[model samples]
Target: MEFMLDLAVSVVSLLVVGFYTWSLRGHFYSPKMATGAKLISAVVIATTLFFLYLAWYEHQVAWVQIVGLVIEICAAALFWWAVSASRKARLRFAFDPDHPDSIVTTGPYRYLRHPFYTSYLMFWSGWAIASSSTWAVVPVIAFVIIYVSAALGEEKKFSKSPLAPEYEAYRRKTGFLIPRFDQR
Candidate 1:
């Protein structure tokens, strides 16, 4: 059962990466941004591979792995939803410095201003928790900083755009990473 859970964790991690990559199809990014994105993607994939190694060779508690698996599943679903919703919006690479052409408020975007970053953090946090080692936290913290910086950069761009008024309204209704339950 434990082995099965570990395998599932790895499988889901890979599937999420595929989903993310598919979402980038046909989107043009600057050379520098593309390079940065590829580097970040490689690092994230390497981290998942490391977790897979630990799961298969090292001892991890079954229940903790189960919890992490559940979180991973949630992250995957959220990411898919965000991707689907933003498909028409032409998603941009992180730290692109380009103004958004549209404001997406449907699907996961309705609840979170940065659903992609939220899902990314959830996946990283899930894998770290699944590892069931205090050392796993180092990567999680690093990812948190990276995603937060990207999200803040995007937010700053939005604030400076002509859509600032519209974005400000959406920002108030949506949470940064968590959903605002009282946002009616």
Candidate 2:
């Protein structure tokens, strides 16, 4: 019964992610959005949720739970920051993937090349650690690989734009997912 409930939760989470991604498809990368990528994300989320359920059932230590909570909070903050930055950039400046517009240098983009993906990774990593189950780690690893691949692909596509040179310089200075506090 517990397994079934967990599975349901996993499915629901995947559906939510899928819907969100679908809604943002055209605004970001390839207007069509890759079906394969979406499917992969769904599988990864499902797997992670399953492992999370197992971990929850096992009952980890209090300290681990607290650490997990902190990580999750950080992840949420990062995600929110990324979204806000994106919105500001969209409003203040124009970005047309089809037309190849200017690169986004403000907001979170000023620090991390891929703030959204970074936040997502942090969230998943925290979830895996919180679960502290070997099974949970599997999905986290898979999610990292998938996200990295997608980011690389997006970068390649974005490189064709006129702002490619500027973006390249930004990429050289900033970390892929994590922001460097010491560097201005």
TM-score of each: 0.91, 0.74
lDDT of 1 by residue, 7-40 (tens): 8877887787677676555443443565556666
How well does candidate 1 score on lDDT at residue 81?
A: 84
Error of 1 at 2 (Å): 2.6
Candidate 2: Cα lDDT at 54:
62
Which residue window of length 10 is worst by lDDT in model 1?
23-32
Lowest lDDT 10-residue stretch of candidate 2: 88-97
lDDT of 2: 0.60
Q: How many backbone clashes does candidate 2 have?
A: 0
Error of 2 at 49 (Å): 3.2
